[model samples]
Each structure stands twice: as structure tokens, then as C-alpha cells.
Target: MANTHEMTVPVTRPTAARQPHPSGRRLTAHLASVADDLTALWQRLEDDPAVAFHQGRAWVEAWREATGANLCLVTLEQDGAAVAMLPLEIKRSCGLSIARFAGTAFSNENTGLLDSVRLADLAPVTADELALTLSQAGLGADVVLFDKLTPATAADAPYSALPKVFHQNPSFQLPLFADFSAVLAQINGKRRRKKMRVSERRLEAMGGYRHLIGEDDALALRLLETFFRQKALRFAAQGLPDVFADPAVRTFLRILATDRDANGRAALELHGLELAGGDHEGEIIAVSGLTLKHGHVTCQFGSINDVIAADVSAGELLFYRMIERAALAGHKLFDFGVGDQSYKRSWCPQRTELVDCYVPLNLKGRLAAPLIAGMIRLKRVIKTSPGLHRLATWLRGLPVRRQKAAAEPD
Candidate 1:
């Protein structure tokens, strides 16, 4: 049996409740009391076409295993039918309870689930009501943070509508076409698109190259291992924290890579570029991790071989092939996910803006919210400025440098 914690917030008529909504049905908010109930609610929400893979049950389960956070799944129901749901994971930070959307650390999109039927009827609780319930739920959280939420999610999703500090985190996306050539034609720079083909030819001339899409678990695992190693080297060189260094996160990704949904489609798809001959024969030159669902393919993470064949732009070549694959699979969108990269802009013409919403549940939270918002803003400024970003990178590498020195022979 799965351990569960639940709380129910009653709602009378609109006149009685603190927040007012359109008169149609009285909705009551409650946390899932058991694993069975949570699973059932999750299934119902997953049925909605708006629910993304990150907000799905499989991803949530993987997050639970990876982080072991206290699950707090809230549901708003009308006449016993679930209308909305917000999945959260609670943890203590700096002696204060903090609740954030489940899988926020790794998930590119964090959209709360909402029943399409209820949404059509405009019967689901508003953002205000949801926030009020969470604040009074007695979950002992000092603050609730919802990150990377978009306005289109869940009928005016609370993250963007709530009275809180909003921080920008934009994502890039490309609309897929029926053919690869059509997609390439839409890219802004003609020279850039031509250059991509030149890069592919360059890679081909060096013996040969192949785009490998791993469907089998064994092959996927091998590719994933390579991805981790390459990612570690890249991060170390850039002086950035290696998030994949954690064993738990690695295990979670491995499980995700191998997992298939009821439709037999993998939760995570592994794609790589392999050199067929020469000094780098059989070497995985570049690898990209992706998630496909509801006609959308999201790039989770990707890395390339900077040491060998750097001039060929293996990563860019890999993306061209992957985008073609997604287009052939009838996907509607190819999302670069959250980031500001020069390559992303080359492929994705549309920029989807995202925001982080923070709500204080108590006195302590009130004090922490501004500090958190300021920090996020500062980081954004640093990331956008090349000089500051380089300085920040150097500062981050100091710890690793010290560790290396300590291990060196005297």
C-alpha cells in the first residue's frame, strides 16, 4: 500500500466562499488520501488532451523515486467528479517547508491537469480558489512554488494568475511540417540552413555517419550512459553543476528511457549520431534525449563530442535528423524546451514565454518569496550577459579545482 496524506477544503455557495466563481456547481478541493485514489485521479486527468508528458503519472512516479519527496496531490471535484488537479512534492529547505510542482527540477513544462469536459463547461475552480485552498490546507508548507507554467494550461492556470512574483523563463518551439525540406525552408537564415547541410556533408565525408534511434532497452541504456559521460565532460568544461552526476537522477532517467506507455510508445526516446569509420568509428558523436506525446516532441537534453570532429557540428546534424524523424512521425511541434541557445533560435521561430509563480503560505514564506525572486532575476541577468556568465562559470569551477589539487600528488 502506498502511504498517502490528504486534506479536504469545503466550499459552500459562491456567497459563502472567500472567492467567487460562476454559478454552476459547487466544487470541493481535496488531497488524494491514498495511492489508489491518486492513481485513479491521475488517469482521469491524463485522459485530457491538454495534459503533457511531464504532468503525466509516469513522470510523477519517476520523480517520486528520484527525489523521494512527500507527495501532495490536490484535486478539485464537483459532484464526485474531478475537475482539476495540482501535483506537488513537499520538502524542507533551510528549516522551512517548501512545496513545488512535482518534477520541476528536470521538467521543461509544468502544466497542471484539468478535465477537458469541466473546462468546456467553465465549471472548474478558478486560480484564486485553488491558491486559497492550498494556503489553508495545513500542509505545513511555508511557500508554494510553481515553475515554468504557461497561460494556455488548465483554463487560466493558477501559476500565472495567482498574486505572486512572476519570473520569465522562455522556451522555443518549431511547428513541424509534412516534409523535412518544408521545415528547413521555414528557418530564418538561408545561409544558416545551407550551412547545416554543409556540416552534414562534412561529417559524411569523414568516412560515414548514421543517426541511431534506440527502441530497445539495452541500446537505449548504452546510449544513455554515453550521454551522461559526454554531458559530464561538457559541464565540467563549462564550469556548470552536473545535475546528472546524482545516481538517483541517473536511475530515474534509465527507468524513463525504458518505460513504455499503454500505447507501447517509450516515455523517453534516445537518438544519437554515430561515426561509421575513421578514428572515431562506432563512436556516438552526439546524443539527444526526447519525449513525444500528443503530437509534440520535447528535447529533454542533448550533448555532442567536442573532442573529436568538433568542426562537423555533430550536435546540429543530430538535431536535423531528429527533427525530420519527429516530422515523419506526424508530430505537430518540436519544442527546444526551456533555454536560450543560439542553435535553438536557428530551428525554433516561436518563443513561448513561461513564468514562475511563488505564493507565501505563512509569515516565513512572506520573507523568503522576494529573496527567491531576486535571486532568479539575478541569475537571468548573468546568463544573458556573456562576460558575467563567464565570470560566474569560473567561480563555480573553484570547488572542482580545489578538489583536483587536493587529490594531486604532493
Candidate 2:
């Protein structure tokens, strides 16, 4: 038998009063709000190690501050002990409600932050129970979006069985390696070393490369600014909003740079490397800000120069050094986060899948259900077809000429 943590929760109908839909057939939940109870549930699950950073408390706070979202927690408890939790934020736009797990849109991975042990047997029961409970609590969102949920989460999730639920998009995650040699082997040691040699020779021909790990407040700010500029350039070239366009992004980065654990130590360790030589001139070539916590390090944010003077391999080198430093720092896992880019796969052997699902409650749900269903189907069509995805990527690259032109002045 699995532990209590692994038990599936049984679902029950909403006991609260509900108003009849216009169709006079369907019903909506009418239970009094239970935000307090739900918050406690969120805290309990967040305190666990199984949850990823996106679903963690810090991210929730950061997202609320950055997006000004209305956050609410929901949970199911038996005998006063919480069994499951969902931290959802509702956004109203265009007269429609968008419901999603707190901090999900920007961050990768949006699983319910469930206790695997407690849910082992309850996988079948979890979703239904959650739906009923949420309806009772007046979760009035017309659409609920869950992004980048690990595959296992879907398999174990309670409501994934709904036939209308469909998957259209997918992302990838890379594993962090503790062994330097292992990483080298994966990326083609001989070829990579040769490239490194060439870069070194070219760099030497100029002058020499300089590496600087930021120290103190001012220097950290400068390095972070450089990273933002470079990252924005990359996004503009690709025709996407540099998420860091908002000052909040910078504020968050700086907080990580200067923050520390409860014991009062450096919370952020940001690296800034400068490369200069004959015509090369001194310029920021690579910058990476890694968050360290509980023996784990995440490549939180980073950017590299695309200029000719810089080496394509510098970013890899910086990552290599980060791995070494992480080991030295006694960290165990390094997460590359979500995305299925080829570079990520070069270093990661492990892959996790994300999932989304839906259920309807009233006449409005019945009416909107088809649109949601169509979107899900269309998404699948686009994702499974390589040609379509390529076309999308290409189209995404076109409108960014303005951003690219703006960056050119840099």
C-alpha cells in the first residue's frame, strides 16, 4: 500500500447552494468563500520539496507583485488535515475570466504541487474532488489554463480523463549534471575543446579575456543591466517581448542577486565575463545569474553577446564554470527549466512532459466549452506538425524588426 500521501481523494457533488443557469438545466456552485482554509493548504504543499519553483511561495509573491493578479488558494481537507492544494489566480479580461495556477504563465511547470506520497492511490479521485470543492468555493473562472505540467502530473492528476481535454503544445526540460567530464562527453569533448582552443587563440590575438563575478550591490546592478540589454536584443531579434521589458523583472533579478537564505548569505551569485583584444575592445560577453538554495542551483537568468568578437562557445563555458561552482557550492541539482530547444537536449538526458485539462459547470461553460475544445485541437495540430511549428516560429520573427533596429543602436 502507498503512504497516506499517495491516497486518491474521492469526489463529491457540491453541497453549497447554486443558481440555475439560463438554460434552466445546469447549476453553479454557491458555497461561501473559503480563502483562509485554502491559503493554509497552499502553504502546506509549498513547504514540501516535491513542488517546483514556479509553484513555490516566492514565485507566487513575485508574480502577484509583478502582475497585480488576484490570487486565491483552494484545497480539500479531511479531519482538519489538508490533502490537496491549488493556488489559482483569476484574471478578468474582455469580460471573460482566465483562471490559472499562480505564477504559471511566465514560469515553466504548473502542476498542482500535490504530495506524491499522499496521492499515489488518489490519482483517480483527485480531479473530481478538486472540481467539486472549487465550485463550492465560488471559483468562477470560465477558462483554466495549466502550462508546462510534467507528464507524471497528468498521469496522476485527478481530472485528466475528461474527453474534451486535449493537448496541443509541449515544452522540454534539461537535467543538470554534477560531473564536468560527463557534460563534456555529451557535448562532444574533442570538437568542443577544438572550438575552445580556436576561441582562446583569437581572444589571445586581441588581448585577453577577463572574467568578473559580481561583488556587492553596485557591480551586481551593472552586470544585471548588461544581461537585460543582451537578453532584450535576443528577444527582439526573435520578435518576442523581452519579459524583462518591465522594471519588475529587473527588480526581481536584483533581489535574487542580493538576497540570501535565512542564515544571511549571498542569495545570488551572478557572473559577468568581459572579452577584449586588438579590435575586440572591452565588452560584456556573457552574464549569468544563478539562484542558490538548499543545495540546488537554477540557471535563473542569463544572456550572451552575439557580436563577432565573442565566441559562440562562451555561453557554454560559462555554464561549465557554473556547474563546477555549483559542485563547489555543495548544490545537488541544477535545473535548466522548461523548453525543448536543441541546446538544452545536448546537456540533458531526462525529459518531462506538461499537461492541461478542463471541466465545465454551468450553461456558460457549456457554451464556451466548444471554443476551448477547438483551441485545444488546433494547438495539437500545430504542435504535432513540424512544418506548422516552423512557420509559426518564422512568422514570430518578422515583426521584431523594430526591436532589432532599436537594439542595433547598442
Candidate 3:
């Protein structure tokens, strides 16, 4: 049965309350059908450095609204205060109900639930108490799969401490120094400056350009539409799938850009480089979306106007502007998010380790776990091996390559 508001269960003891929890304190898992239940808890931890923006209440709610995914929140409360929680979107697949972290496919990293208090180190539990509780609590999930987890995840609890394999693609981030020059030194300062100078001269000749931040809601929405068009064209050129082709995704991104909290902190922020007064005056050259929380900022996605993108390097210039602003604002890290692009590698020096964890709650899950694990392993090998990765890319691009060859004058 699908999770419903009627299935909402209050905070209570775990159904499998046999032994004491390893933390010497109870961390009981409870089922909540509505994500609104987290509003109160989110208020307490919204600013907590431990709580990532991907797990932020607004971000989660936006995803749910946009995708219409069934929400099944598993909250662990201790002494009445919520210590940790997992907001999952239950999906039925292969005769089994699988509970996955909401927005997992789009998220850069998953920090499997962590105690908000950051309590002292606790011994690892042999059994997955959270999973056990979830199984019996009956949200109708046969398996709980958590993936794209960063190595920085807390691992004392059963849910997070289980055996796992490295995730497909590791995330990347760069330290943001207050002095912009100091930041440059960490990533080929000389070469970066030379490129920046060249881009500046080119842009200057083209009636100059201005970096525009989407502070205005209307302008931000417009920029977002432009980004979609740019990305669709780019993806078509590369023969890659257009992830943004889904209307739901577009709606989700729009919500992220518009929905804001009392503090004006929206789930997504947009920035672009626009032509000032050239023949294509006011036309956007590059667009980027970002998510910021506490002192960390992550690039969600970016697109460029490829037709006129030869020597201007609009994308790089936009990043330089944003990175400088982030650094000046004292943000600690500028994450490049998921993927292994040449630009990401050159910009971000720190590679964050990622992992996946799967817990089977029933016979069906147990039977299917191995198959799922094997597939994940294969994907990891392909992503991590340079030769395999190159071959895979070449294969994926074959259609476009073949088309171009056929169109050439013989």
C-alpha cells in the first residue's frame, strides 16, 4: 500500500526494542507520511553545519512537490528532540518496495543521518536497528537503499555504519580563501589569470559583459528558462540525454529558485553573464545554478551559449566571479558537485569519497540485493577507470559522431 497521511505514526519506541541502543541513548525511528512534520525540527538544525542543504526542508519539499513522489520520513528522536532523520521517496520496483533518499539521483552527496548534537563517539552496532525498526514500523518498504553518501558521513549508527562500496562518482570541492588571489594560487594561478585576461579582452571587444546574479525573482526565472534552452542544445550536440527534458524537473528547479524561507534563503540561486550592449545586447552567454548552506556553496548545474562561446570563456569568467564573491563572503568550500568534468577537476582539488549502503528488510530484498550491488560495482569500475570511462564516453557519442561524418562533403 502507498504511504498516506493516515499511516502517520508518532514518535515512539522502536517496535524491536529488545537490546539497548549502542549510543547509550535511544534513537527511535518513527514514520511520517507528510514532510511538513519536519518543519519544527528543520528550524533547529537549518543553520547547523552538520545539516547539508541537500537535506534542507525547503529543498526536500520542493522535490516532493515537483515530482509528486511519495514521502516517507524516518525520524530518530532522542529525549524528545530529533537527532537524525531520513526523508525517503518509496518506489516500487521488481515486486519490491524500495525506499531511497529523496532527490538521490540529483544530489551530489548523501551524509547518512547524523545526530544533530554531534554526541561523543559511540560503538558501532552489529544490527541495523533503524532498518529493523523501519521494517516492522510498516511504511511498506522491502528495502532501504542509501547511495551517493560522502565519506564524511557519521558511521556509528546501524543505518550508516553498514558494509558498503564506493559510490560511482566522487564529489569535488575547493577551499575558498578570503583573498581571491590566494584562491587562485591553489589552482594554477598563472594560467588562470592569463585565461581570465584573454576572456576579458574578448568580452570587452564585444561591447563588454556584465555578470548578473538572479536577485530578482522574475529575472532569475527567465535566466532559468534560458539555461534550459542552452542545455538542451548542448546535450543534443553531444548526443547525451537531456536530463532537463522532464517538465517535473523544470518545475522543481523553478521552485528551488523561487521558494524562500523567512531569511530569503531559497533552495537554488541563479547567476549569468550577459552581453551588455553588443548586436546581441542583453543576451546571456552563460548560466549557472548554485545551492548554499552555512559556509559551503555547491554548483548545481551550468550551461553556456555554445554558438558564441569560442574565445570568450564565459563559463570560466562566471565561475571566477561567483567564486570570488563566495570567498569574500567567507564561505569555506566551493563544491563542484558530482561528475568528473575537466573543468571540475581543474577547479576543485579536493575529491570527496562517496559510498552506497543497502539494507534488506525482507526475503525479496535479500534476493535482489546482490544483483543491485553487482550493478553498482560495475558502474563504479567504469567511472573510476580512465580507459573504461573514455571508451564508454566514445560509445555514447558514436551516434553524433556518425551523423557528423555522414554530413561531411565527400
Clashes found in each candidate (C-alpha, N, C closer than 3 A): 0, 21, 0
lDDT of each: 0.75, 0.60, 0.77
Q: Estimate the lDDT of model 3.
A: 0.77
lDDT of 3 at 377: 84
Model 3 backbone overlap count: 0
For model 3, give the 10-residue run with minimal summed lDDT: 1-10
User: Order the candidates by lDDT, highest first — what do you get?
Assistant: 3, 1, 2
Q: How high is each candidate's TM-score?
A: 0.87, 0.75, 0.87
Q: Which candidate has the highest lDDT of all?
A: 3
Misplaced by over 4 Å in model 2 are: 1-44, 121-128, 157-178, 204-206, 210-217, 255-257, 263-269, 276-282, 291-297, 327-332, 373-377, 380-386, 397-410
Model 2: lDDT of residue 384: 65
Error of 1 at 85 (Å): 1.6
Report clash pairs, candidate 1. Answer: none
Candidate 3 global TM-score? 0.87
Give one digit per residue, the lDDT tens place, for model 2 in 341-401: 5555555544444455665545565467567767767866776678988887777666665
lDDT string for model 1 (207-272, tens) is 888888878888898889999999999987875678899998998898899888676667889999
